[model samples]
Target: MWLDAVDGYRHLTPESLKAAMPRCPRPVAWARALDDAIEFWGVTDIAMLLAQVGHESADLTRLVESLHYSAERLMAVWPSRFETYARASQFAGYPEKLANEVYGGRLGNIEPGDGWRFRGRGPLQLTGRYNYTAFATAIDDDAPIKTPQLVAEPIYGALSACWYFVTRVTPRASIEVATREINGGLIGLADRRRRYEQASRALEA
Candidate 1:
C-alpha cells in the first residue's frame, strides 16, 4: 500500500530497500529518508543512485572510509604518490599518518586530527573537510561538519548520495558522467555499469 505512493520508487520501503541491501542498517528509516531525499532533490534515476550507493558504500554497510591500512596496503593504495611513506614505516599509526599526510591542510581541514575527523563518510564517500562543509551547507545541517561522524549513519549516507546525484548527475543524465563526478574518474566503471543495469532492472520491474 505505502510502496505504491513512493514516487514509483519502492526501492526505499523496508522490504524493498532491505532487498536491495540486506545488511542495510536501520532499514526502515533509511528507506524513508532515501525516498524523501530522492523526491525532494528531484533525482530522476533511482537505478543510478542505487548503483552509486551500492558501489561506494558497499550496499550501505560502510559509510566511513576504512583507512586501516598496513604499509603494504598503503603502498598498494597510493603507490605512485607516497612511495617514501609507504617504504618508511608499517605500524599501528599507519592509517593516521596516511590520513594526515594525504588529507591534512587540504579541503578546509587545517588542524591535526581534522584529517581523520573529516574523513570520507556517507554513501558517496564524501571526503575531505571542504566536502563535509559543503554537504552540511547544502542540506542546511551543521552536524556533518561539526560532528562529521554522524554522516556515517546510513540515513545521511543515502541523503548525501542523493545530493550527489541531484547536483552532479541530473545535469548530465549520464551515468558515466555521474560516475566521474562521484568517483573523480572511472575507477569502478565496469562494476558501476553492472550495478546500474542490475538496479535498473530491479527498479523498473
Candidate 2:
C-alpha cells in the first residue's frame, strides 16, 4: 500500500480509510486515489485532509455543488446578493439562474455561461474560471479547464481536494484554521471538528 511509504500514515489500509468515511461509495478507489494525491502533493496531514473532504463532500458522496436553495437559504447564504425575500425568491429553485446571479462577473467568469458551467465541483467544490485554470496548470493538464466536471470523478476529485489543501489552506494545524481558510468562515465548525477527531482516531486504529 502507498501509505506504507509515508511516516505517520503507514497504518492506513483501504479498510481503515473506509472505516473513517463510512458513506464513501467507492472506498477502494478513494483509498488508492487518496494515496496517489497525498504522495504527489506531499501532504503530511492526512487526518485533516480526510476531515476536510468528509465535511465538504459528505465523504465524496456530493462531488458537485447543489445550487438549489429556498428563498430563506439563499438570503442567508448570500445576504449581500439576495437582499430581500422577493429578490431571493426569483432565483430560488432555479440553480442556473442562482449560480449566474451569484458567481457571474467575478472569479474570472466574464463569459456568458461561465458561472453555471464552472459552478463548484469536486470534493473541495472547485469553483470559478480562475481556479479551474490554475488547477489545470497544477495538474499539467487542460482537462480541468476544458471539462470542469471531470473534477467530480473520484480520482480527480481526490487529487483536486488534496491540491487545494496543500496550496491554498494556510496554517492548517487545526480544524478551525483549515475551515476558515477553505470556507472563508467557520460555517460548519462543529461538524468539521467532529470529523477531524474521527479521522485522527481512525488513522491510529
Candidate 3:
C-alpha cells in the first residue's frame, strides 16, 4: 500500500542513495526501511522528507538526542527553570538531569523517569513520553511506550518520522511549518531549508 504511493522514490535504490550522499553511505537496509516508511506514510514531498531525516539524524548517523549541557547551557535552554531545577546553580548538570527537570511530568510523562527514558530518538528525533505513546498507539505497539528507545532504530525511526510528517506536517507542505512542529520553533530554519534544497536536487537527479 505504501510503496504504491511513493512515486518520487519508487525507483530510489540503496545504490542511488549512496551515490547521492557519498560522505555518509547508507546501507541497503537503510534504503529499504526509508523507502518503505516514506511509502507507508503516504508522503509526496520527497525533498522535505529527505532533508528532515538528514538534519534531524545527522544523515541517520545519530538516533539518540544528546542533551549534555553545562549549567550555563542549561540556563540558556531553559532560562526561567534553571534556577528552579538546578540546586547547585554552578554546573548546568548532566543531560539526564536536565531532561528530567525540563521534560518530567509533561508531554505524557507519568512516572519518575519518564523524561529521560522517552527523550528524543530516531531520525525524526521524537521527544516526550506523550508523543512516544501516540506513535505506539498509531503503530499498535506498546514497546515504544514501555521502552521508547526502540524508536531510535532505523526502521522504527523512519516509520515514526514518516508518521509525524503525514499527520503533523504534510498539510502545510512548507519546511518552515514542519520545522516549527518538529523543533518547537525555527531554531535551524536556515540549515533545514538548505538541506531540503540539496535533497531535492539530489533526489531529482
Candidate 4:
C-alpha cells in the first residue's frame, strides 16, 4: 500500500498535484519539477516524502494553507520559527529558539545568522540561505530562491527541497539526518519515518 501510494504520488500530474495542494495553479510545471527532483535525488519512497509533508504541514489541507507564491510569504507565515524570532532580539539568540522549539534544541546553537545555518523552507522545509541559493543555482532560474514563496511554489518548492536533500544532506545520511534537516532535528523525524515506513509497507502489501 505504501509503495503503491509512493508510486502513485511519483506519477501525479500537475492537475493532481494542484488538487493535492491548497492553492492549485493552472500549470503542471510545479508537478513536473517535483517529480524530476525526486527522480534526481533517487528518492524511491514517494510515500515517505508525502508522509513527511503531511506531518510537517499538519495534514494536506493545512499544508495548502501554508503555501505562498514566494519566499517572503512563506517566511511571514511560517509559524514555527516566527515564535522563536519574535522572542529573540538578535541573530545570536536565534539558535536558542531554533534549538528549543524547532530542533528540540538538540543541534545546539544552529540557527539563522549563526553558523550551522540553513534551516527550513519549501515542501521539505529547507533551512538556510546557503542551501536555498544552492537549490536556486541547481534549478537555474530567475526566481528569488531565498524567499518562501518560491519554496512554496508547488513544483519549485518540491524541487528545492529535494535538491537540498539529495545534494546537501547526502544519500548516506540516515533518515535521522534528513529528518533533522527537514524537521529541525528533533524527535518528530523518527515517528514520521516510522509512519512513512508503515505507509510504504501498506502500499507494497
CA lDDT of each candidate? 0.74, 0.84, 0.74, 0.51
- After superposing candidate 1 on the true structure, give the runs of residues whose Cα lies further than 4 Å from its correct spot: 1-11, 22-25, 85-93, 170-172
Quick one: ranking by TM-score, best first? Answer: 2, 3, 1, 4
- What's the alpha carbon RMSD for model 3? 3.4
Q: Which lDDT tens digits does candidate 2 get at residues 65-155?
A: 8899999999898999889999999999999998888999999899988999999999899999988888888888888888888899867
Report the lDDT tens digits of candidate 4 across residue range 46-150. 655655665665433332222212333324545455445433333233443433344432333244442223344456665545555666677676463435456
Pairs in steric clash, model 2: none
Model 4 earns a TM-score of 0.50
Instruction: Tell how far residue 72 is off in model 3, in angstroms.
Output: 1.1
Off by over 4 Å in 4: 1-33, 60-120, 146-148, 168-174, 202-205
- Of candidates 4 and 3, the better by TM-score: 3
> Candidate 2: lDDT over CA atoms?
0.84
Indicate which candidate wins on lDDT: 2
The best candidate in terms of TM-score: 2
TM-scores for all candidates: the values are: 0.84, 0.90, 0.85, 0.50
Over all chains combined, what TM-score does candidate 3 have?
Answer: 0.85
Clashing residue pairs in candidate 3 (N, C-alpha, C atoms within 3 angstroms): 70-92, 71-92
Candidate 3 local lDDT, 1-205, one digit each (tens):
2244443446356665554444444557677777888667777876787777777777778889888776666666677776544552643547777677788988888889888998889888888988898888887778888877778876787789889878777464688888887777887788889888877677767
Residue 169 of model 2, lDDT score: 74
As a whole number from 0 to 100, the lDDT of residue 188 in candidate 4 is: 79
